[model samples]
Target: MTRAQHPAGDPGEVARAFEEMPAVLWAFAGPQHRVVAANRAARASVGDREGIVGRPIREVVPEMAGQQIFEMIDEVYATGHPVSHADRRVLVDRDGDGHLEEDFYTYTFLPTRGPDGAVTGMVVHIVETTRWVRQRQAVEARADDSERRYREARDVVLGLQRSLLPAGVPLLPRLRIAARYVVAGADAAAGGDWFDSVVLPDDRVALLVGDVVGHGAEAAGVMGQLRAVALQALVSGAGVLDSLRRLDTLAGCLPAAVGATVCLVVVDPRTGDLEYASRAHPAPLLLGPGGSARFLDGAPTGPLGADGKPARRHHDRLGPGELVVLYSDGLIERPGQALSAGQAELARVATAVLSEPVAPGSTLPALTADRLGALLVERFAWAGYRDDVTVLVAERQPEPPEPPALRLPAIPASLAAVRVAMRAWLGALGVPALPAQAVQHTLGEAAANAVEHAYRAGDPGEFTVAAGLDERGVLRLTVTDRGRWRPAPDDPQDRGRGLMLMRALADRVEVAAGELGTAVTIEHRLQRPAQVSAGAAPPEPAAEAREVPFRIEAGADGPRVLRVSGPVDLATAGELERAVRAAGRGGLLPVTLDLAGVTLLSSGGVRLLHRLDAGADPAGLRLRAPRGGAVHQVLALTGLEHLVT
Candidate 1:
């Protein structure tokens, strides 16, 4: 039943089936390529049905004249060969509106041969592909736009990341500090990473490295805010745990900083004492002078905005010539590698780089902190990183040579000798000129007190002066005498002035008296400016004394105003005292000292003011200094702010 009902070999039925097919079919006869037959689809494609048959191909579809379709049909008829095209574009007025529209087709022109094997006609087959082609083009356009947006966001985030980082690490006397930051690979977006070094008020160096959880501008902004908060806390002398607590609180307020991590280390370079705290950050690696390295993982806590877990401060000490390395997790994180393995590799690489022998004739005594940081970053990130990487190195410098002790006879001449010795010692210690002069003058007073009161009249005795800088950079000067101690008389004018002067000049002063005589101990924390390098030679003393620029101007019939525009330290304080005395004219005239222009108001300068104030009436001598100026600050610290007008 199936075979008989199929009508498989019926000529009329086969022709009907071919004409009803979905593909467009047609035939052209002779060299003119005159169309002889066309199916329903082919006739409809040209916007004609009855008029499309029994006509030349160009006449049937006038728009095909310049499209070479007729030439292909003629070639197939003449050569008995076939031509085919895939996705061929054709412009046709399919709706008969006199406007051509684009269309794509996969079509073939096959030669139809006669019984003699000579080509008699050509048959064409076509399939429209316009819908598929348009769909693909639309998808590609969306992809291109998305890629462009991604790149723009990445660029913006990278710029923010760089601007948020510190421009340079602080240069310190006891600590050599350096930092480096590296971005991720080119294909990856910029991640949030930052590093900073701040020299605290106590001369301790604070090093920090941190990472935020995500990428792009949000991550960068969160990183910048966190860094700012941490820096502010540290500069305010907040302890390690306290600073991290502040950072954690801020991170809790920021959704982007939820998983942020940071490691902070504050180190007293003079004592090699380091205290550190971390919030789910990697432990710092410490490299010793003996070529050994280990991670400081003593104190650890959950990441920022994590479950409540109290942060703790860890205590560790670095030896002279040793280094403490702080870095972001990127430095010790690699794909398919364990976190512990990455950290171990970091320690190994840091040790190798830092332990390498210094080049011959190198100006540095050993590997510098800057060079060490660079090497560590290069070694870990040479193959490229998927996240941002940062490294910070802090190295403790070697101890400076101690100054010699001084022993002099208890006489008036000994005071001068004590001043000379102390000046030389303080200069060798790289103390600034003003502070050095303050120390020298303070010691001179202590020595003069010993010479006058430590012994009975005409009893020869020797006094000893010893000075040493402790591990905390405190200069301790001890003036000892072997004679018996004599109690101060009841009168307040003569006996207690030297002791009061000593307390005012030094940061702390203590007088120990017993049968063994007296020992006056003075302690002052030596402050070194960041610009001065460790072990740098003291600058040559000025051969000629710098002249203080002094000019007296009458203040609108008020008083003679003496403007002093130079440092008022030990070397120049006597000259200033003399000028003030001359201006006073034996306490007969009123004088005002305008200290607004004074660059430095050392303790010697303060003493000169005290003496002048004691001799003249309080109304006769007045001081004028700008509020918040250096002179005003010093006077406030010395309890002499009342003198300023």
Candidate 2:
């Protein structure tokens, strides 16, 4: 460790140590900035120092000749003030490829002052920072990409929430409904808030408003499932409380830690009575005429999925022209406001709206609903709402008057009036085309019979007809006459066919005759095409099959036999189908469907026979020869004999 033994003790070794520094160091000795001495780092950046020394830096790295670095070096040379840059761009042949590559470096240029404080030459030092700069930029790019994905995910969740919400309010018979939905924030994902107006099995209107546990796609998806379950329960005849309990049970079966708050209000359109249940949800606001308002919050249960506790039901009488507001917490909940305060504010707004006089012109129920919903949203949830907001307003419409009955005098004009009234009523009830036509026909026949046979010219009796569709989807028509009965003609041809025609068109026909009056009742079961069961095979005739109107006989020796002894029409087509099917099932070939005993033949009967013949197995059906009877006349007019033969 003696000084003489140390490498620094020798000038040559010292010089070599200085030459091997990691930084790029060099000294320029002239105005042109000629390189006088350079370190190994500098030589490595610009190639061997043998020919580079004593050359201007521009000559060593030609790419740097016209760039700002030379100008900065010249400024330092002229002012004698040192200059430093943290990330100076420099080009050099670091890879010894002859062509220079661009890179970043921390560099400093200083004036080497002489004895009289005058600048003599320039000294330079640099450290490459290209790798660090590139690494920092890569990290920043990754952060930006991650933020973009987060926003995209939020947008997708928002879209999902919107898709699952109800498109519009239901058009219940006695309700004017309006609703609105708002999301929490622009950047935040959509939360689980929803509202619906569904028609329950009892024909009551169920108004629902709910909020699920959280935000984003998961909450929105859970909201959809819970809404469906609640509606299904109501549609299946569950009461308000029962429906909420059912939803709570369903929520329990879902993934753990999920929960929701719901409010269900079932309103009976007939009585203006509302049965409501709440699952830790806020109360509904009742706004009446002249700015009267109150909150229906008596019933409260644990939030849905909270250990499945049974819920309580509350009842309130909602009169005509009164408004009921149901909403999620998001509607009233805002910063610096308690839930009770929000509820109070909502009541105030609802009352204000109610106080406004209805415009001179009529306002549509849907438009009123929309206007109220918009007002409530604008009042309480305009800005900075931290949760999804949903508001539903329902106004009880006045009970509609009972449909009028037709009390027509016993005259030909009365028959047409009955038909017109029946058709109008059927159309209002949304009766399908097929069932409506049948009703019109049967009702017309009953009225016409009363006009033609129930009274004489001097008696001038009156007749009344009434029709309606019951909750079971059955159409009922009642026709009554206040006249003396007339005896039937002894000959079949002379007797009228009014009674037979009515029986043919209706599913059931009931006739009662007395001195007071005669009343006929006709009933038809109305079924949507999709609801008719494919397996509703025709029933076999009763034990008194011989007394039945239609009979079938199967045989291989000749065509099968289907004999009709009564009028063949809508009411009796089913009997013919059953007989035909029974005969066909017996596997008899070349079946004969005989219509020899058909006293009357209607379009319904002809239609059934045509379908059977057209779809029968090849050469499967043949008809017995007709001899100018009603059945033969119908076949000849309709050209149906070709299929049978």
Candidate 3:
């Protein structure tokens, strides 16, 4: 086409337009690839404009020598074709400095044909894209960092939740317990859900489940504090309402604990009586032995730190072989579902799982409770829970067997037999060695009173020792003799020392005199460890005889330390007094009596110590006993704690 036909399409017009355009444009000629024309953008990109036109492309941009741009332009010119690249990295010394700077660009190389239709030269168009590329990279880096921080926070919250939960449930004679905890979905922050069980001093079992508001570390921390406070109150024999009241007051102090929810239930394993209180928590579910399930939602209260109204206590009973379940709201909450529907689904799933016949030889409620809890968690949380899920199951077993009874004559010799028999009985009942020793010492004192005071001389009266472990787990021992009950003497030196010892050791002690005889009954509650299973067989007693030869080794040196070993009781009290007298050497030097090896320190030994202290100087006699040992505990209980060194 001629320039006269379309003035705008003239070569000069096109060249002028290219010179003023913002894009980099250049025209190359011949095989040497000389620069035929250069635009303003082109000169600016090279950071120099002097002597650029009519120069070879290599002379104008010397930094591009090793780059593939020369070859690409040559290929386009020879083949009469076009080539394009996007975001290509290029290094250039734009400021004429020896150092090279990196940048990104998109460029196209187009061939220009001559009149004979042969490729004559190439036209190149280039655009810089460095700013856009860097922006995109910065955004991606920020996203990656945010994701890493979120994962770390979730891990910390999860760790806190697990650490705050109960390590293991208590094992009681007539009760079985098990618990399970499940975290939220993989991408979600951890929610606070926890469960706990404790055996109260009155032999009642307390079950607790709680959920703190919100998610992450704050929620977990609040849940931990609430759990600790609730446990302390309940284990200390606080009533259900009283414990919840304490938690309510505590919630007022903790900002994060506001609106937290908890359900506390105390059950009497012996009678299947349950007393529970709620703080905006879900009701407990009772699973009957006949596969029937029901929710104990009769009583409900507002959340903690809400209205000042006192929480109401609810009462229920668990039948034999029936199990009660306490759980966090997460166990029954489902997305896009009503609360009632979720609860019904939970009841259905639990009943279905528990309806199946129990495995043979798994009659122990512990195994059954464990299986139930695991199955419940599996059924409800298998699809990835949105909140933390927790479930606790407890079932009452059959009544335990009665403890054995013992009968012995009212004499000093019967003291040793009483100790041996009581030791065997208490050990069989899964009682710890320390408590067992305490019980033996208390019963020995009761029996010794019968031998020394209950019957007249030459009366030949007999005393019967009857022992039983009541449903409350209190060890009860009754010593009866067909004799008179002696009253305490007015003189401090001649007072009823054995009676004082019995009262100090046992939880409750009673002495009664009637037409038939005088009876001394002692009661002490047992605190068994979690490792001891319900109705575990009594461990076999060691074959070694109980009679450790009573001996006193008086060191003939400074401080006069006397090492005493063996059973110190009514039969050996005289020997002990005589040995101390002989070792005292006129009571001039201080004497330390080490009772670490004394297996049994009865009231007779305590009375002897009192007499020795009363007659000698205040600092003349010192008693040495191992800390926390049976003998040490005896001395502490008998009001002789100050005498122990």
Tens digits of lDDT, candidate 2, 112-221:
98889888889999898888866864554334434756754656645565578775555443565666676666667767887787767777788899999888777887
Candidate 1: segments with Cα more than 4 A from true spot: 1-258, 264-393, 409-445, 455-462, 472-474, 484-491, 494-508, 525-579, 592-611, 614-618, 624-640
Best by TM-score: 3
Candidate 3 Cα errors over 4 Å, as ranges: 1-173, 176-206, 211-401, 486-492, 526-560, 585-590, 615-619, 627-630, 633-639
Clash counts per candidate, in order, are: 0, 4, 0
Reference-based TM-score of each model: 0.41, 0.40, 0.46
lDDT: which is higher, 1 or 2?
A: 1
Each model's lDDT? 0.70, 0.66, 0.74
List of clashing residue pairs for candidate 1: none
Compared with the true structure, what per-residue lDDT tens digits does model 3 show for residues 1-645? Answer: 678567668778877888899888888887777898888988888887488888889777765643445656666776777888776655566666554555667888888878998888888899988888567645533344347467546566454555777656654557767667767654456576777888788878899988899987778778888999998998788899999999999999998888888999889998999999998998889998777999996667899988767889889999888999998888778667688877777777777556544333221222566667765665454334677777888888766545556677777888877777766655444455566777877888888888877776777877888888755566789988888855535345655667777787789999888988888899887653221111111121222235567788865554378888988988999988877876777676668898977988987888788788888889989998877667887788767778887
Residue 94 Cα positional deviation in candidate 3, in Å, after optimal superposition:
77
Q: In candidate 1, residue 639 scores what lDDT? A: 64
